[model samples]
Target chain A: MPALVLNNISKRYGDVQALDGINLQIQDGEFCVIVGPSGSGKTTLLNIIAGFTKPDDGEVTVDGKPYNQLSPRDRNIGMVFQDIGLFSHLTVRKNISFGLEIKKSSKKDIDKRVEEIADRLKIRKLLDKKVRLLSGGEAQRVAIGRTLITNPSFFLFDEPLGNLDANLRVEMLTEIKRLHLHLKKTFIYVTHDQEQALSAASRVMIMKDGKALQKGPPREIYNNPIGKFVAEFFGVPSMNLIDGTIIPEEDGSLFQGAGLNVKVKGYSQSKKAEVTLGVRPTDVVVGNQITEDGFGTINSLELLGDKNQIYLTLEQEKSIIAVTSPEVRPELEERVKIKLKENRIFLFDRDQGGRLYP
Target chain B: MSERIKRKGKIPVNIIMLLPTNIIILFLIIIPTILVIWFSLVNFQPTFGINFWQSKFVFLDNYFKILMDDEFVKAVIRTVYISLICLGVEFTIGLLIASILTGNIHGKKILYPLLIIPIMIPPIVIGNNFWLIFSANGPVNQIISIILNTEFKASWFSHPKYAIIPIILSEIWHWYPLTFLILFSGLVNISTSEIRAAKILGATEWQLSWRIKFPKLKGIITIALVIRMMEALKVFDVVHLLTHGGPGTRTQTISFYLFKYGFKYSRISYVSAGAWIILFISLLGFSLALRSVLVERK
Candidate 1:
């Protein structure tokens, strides 16, 4: 059964519509991630789910029952905050057992559960210490443990690792994924870090301007984003986009733009003024060219340990990034031939930013 | 301090920078404290042409007399009771007001500052204001009569049974806003995300306030309490102005009684001794309260 569902969820802050008819569903025990940039409504959606912010209109259902009217306490949802909101005055044990204590559970049960969660989170030793004295990673675990002790059916993590260092972030990312697998509870994690979303989520939902642009598995979303925003938003070294017009030929059509020309599907809709041709950096092959005229001059490179990110400029001053092996980097300011797979190219209406057709 | 410490091969600028503060402490705090201590030990009744240097030393004679005197003990106990009442009522009302202010109320900027008008008013004015308001024909009796559905005109001043009521009201009115402001600051400092997290983890409204926001505001509440208690313990202006510790000295706070002895009767030595006693008791109370607060937090 679907563990959680949101239908027609909408919120407005003054003039800004924070969430516009947001619709979503997650299967039981599925790890779901909503990734977006700042002010993109990712946090707003989480707030609405956590019952912190009331949406202007929406139906939030968990376990096939409407929970919109239920307070967060009655809804029985657990949340790990982005700020790692551990109770500073409370000891780690008390902080973790907060929900249980609120529920009026027996002392033995609270102690046993607290100990179990502490051992699982590797914070057993710190249980007696005040939360104010914890390190960043330790505090995060306490926050998670505090949420986990309740044994809620649904878990919401709002950028739980946002404050961690790079190494700690990667480590905690793996730990969180493992926890998700172990708990097997529905998880809705919101974060702007696309890498975290890709590494942690079973499914990725990309949002922008209070709208869900696309939702799918991480690999599928990365390889087949529905719009210009999703295509640019998911990838590491974002997809390169160049403006072009669909030039109608007698037989079919050709994507003709600044130093770019390619065949595309027939257009049936009203003629769009401009089209954007997008392809990821890795899709741009170097050295062995696919066709003639599929080449450009090497502009510059951002050095990486294994592969250098090559910036190639074609005619009309349009540049694209190409990942080239460090040993195979083309000479600076010299011409290097680059080619792209026809299937790998994406098309979008430049004016509206919506995906144009195949 | 941090900036000074960061400098390399420079003069000890931080210590030098503290010269003004050191001078102020010397003149304002140390000298006054020494004089108070000296006067507490001597019979320094300045009105009799006996300067502080000439007064005979009586040691702990005044201390024993004051402690053993039933009138002084009663005054001390009354002050303690009044202080406790003010602390309780002020904290409760202040917490409630702060909670309401933090909500989605309108015109918070104006309402907050307006709420502090009582605190901004002079203590003497606060005393007189309550006295007028609680007079036989004043608003208090009028409101009371309205509530009781009867005619009522009782002289709050002449009524010894309720003499302290006016002082309590006046003091709470003058000070609750200070508690409100401090608690409001603390309420704001409590991270909303923490509250949200607690809510999602199944904390009811009461639990949210009790467990999450309350603990987060512990330090600030302690600070507010300490400040309010200190101010309440030293309450004299309102009491003196409102009832003059009258209705037969029923509302005489420790400070008011000390004023009676210190300036009214020209018993300066006894007053200084009382002042020293108060300082000792307040210090003991303050440390005991703070220590328990810290330990409870742990």
Candidate 2:
């Protein structure tokens, strides 16, 4: 059975809809991530699951039981907030033991659990210190330990490492991934960082404008996006989109725009007049021309330390980006020919933003 | 050696900037306090108006006389008792009101202004109003008669036994708002996450208040207690207006008794001595309280 199910859940704050018809099913022991930009209702969805907030309509079921009826204390769900919501007044030991104390665990059991978790988190020595005295990473660990000591069946992390510095964030991310592997519990994490989502989430739910735009494993999300929004939202430097029109050629089909013509390779039947062509920066190649029906480029290259991103402008002043190794560097304002990898290309209807061809 | 005369002399700017305030403090507060101390040591006649050099020095005689006097001793005890009782009631009720208002209730915003209206009114006005209400055959006695179904009408001001109640009630009503303001600010500053964390950690309602919120509020509570204690000990305006040392000297607080001796009986030296004794007690009490509070925090 799915460990968590959000069925037709909708939430509204006054006239603004924060969550519109969100439905998700997270399997047991699955590390699911909801990825979105700010105000995309990612935190709202997690809050609903953690029972900090209530959905305006529909139901949340946990372990096949209706969860909306349960209060936060009864939800049996552990939450680590983005703000490291540690009890500032309590000692680190007390903060960790708080959950166990609430469960009415025996004092001996509480002590054992707190110690075991603290030792694992490497905060055994800091236990007697007040939470205010702890460093950011230490406080985050204590917050995690506090929630984990309760031994809940599921864990919900709301940008748990967002407050850490670069090195500590990376360390905490790896530690969280390791903890998920060790515990094997249902984990629902939220973040706006695409790289974080790609690295950690087994399955990612991409949210935009208060709704899920696409949901898939990271590879599928990066390679075969379902729409223009999804394609542009993922990947570093993002996918470059070119506006062009499809035309009927003598033999098959050709896409022509801005004094550029490219043979549409794989589509069996294409009659759409207007479409957007999308290709990742890494896939677009710049080299000498071998054919008459391929797009040419007026290239401008930028050095990005290890690699270079060459901007290709066509005759109509339209630009596309191509990622190339710095060793194969193009000179300043060089004229180069371009080829779009047919299999790596993405096509979407201009009006609806829906994917037409992958 | 002649080159040293050419160097610019240091200007005392720190003293310059503070000179005005320092002079005022010394003249208005510090000098009068020192004069009070000096006056308490000397005996003066009505003819010799506070010329301490001409007046014979009578060290500790004023203190001894006031300490041994039965009326002065009773007044001291009554004042202490009344102040302590008023402080306790005000602190407890103020905390209760603050906590209740902190919760999500319907009329909180409206009730804040309404509750503070009583505190904003002048203390003398409140005293007079309470005096009228607690008079013989007044509202309090009428309410008591209807409840008990008896014709027991005791004069609150005239009877020494019933006099302390009115003073306590008036002081409580006037100063409870100060306590409420302090504690309310304390409650607002407490981290809501701590409360939520406590609940999720399985703390019941009682534990949440006592363990989480109360500890967080210790600093503000100390501030509130000290301020309230100081205000209570100097309980003069309301008592003077309500009873004016009463039908006898039952409700004679230190300040009112000082006023009676200094202005009414023209015994300035005795009143000054009494004032110094009260000041010493207040200073010592605050110092001890602060020391204990700090030591306990360790």
- lDDT against the true structure, per candidate, is 0.86, 0.83
Highest-scoring model, TM-score: 1
- TM-score of the B chain in model 1? 0.86
- Candidate 1 lDDT over residue span B178-261, tens digit each: 999999999988887777777777777898898888877877888899999999888899787878898898888899899898
- Provide the DockQ value for model 2: 0.44
Highest-DockQ candidate = 1
Candidate 1 segments exceeding 4 Å error: A250-256, A261-273, A288-290, A302-308, A324-327, B1-32, B46-54, B106-110, B143-152, B293-298
> In each prediction, how many residue pairs overlap at the backbone (N, C-alpha, C within less than 3 A)?
0, 1
Model 1 chain B, poorest ten-residue lDDT window? B1-10
Q: In model 1, what lDDT does residue A43 have?
A: 93
Off by over 4 Å in 2: A242-276, A288-321, A332-336, A349-352, B1-23, B44-53, B69-73, B149-152, B291-298
TM-score result, candidate 2: 0.88
lDDT (0-100) at residue B268 of candidate 2? 71
TM-score of chain A of each: 0.92, 0.91
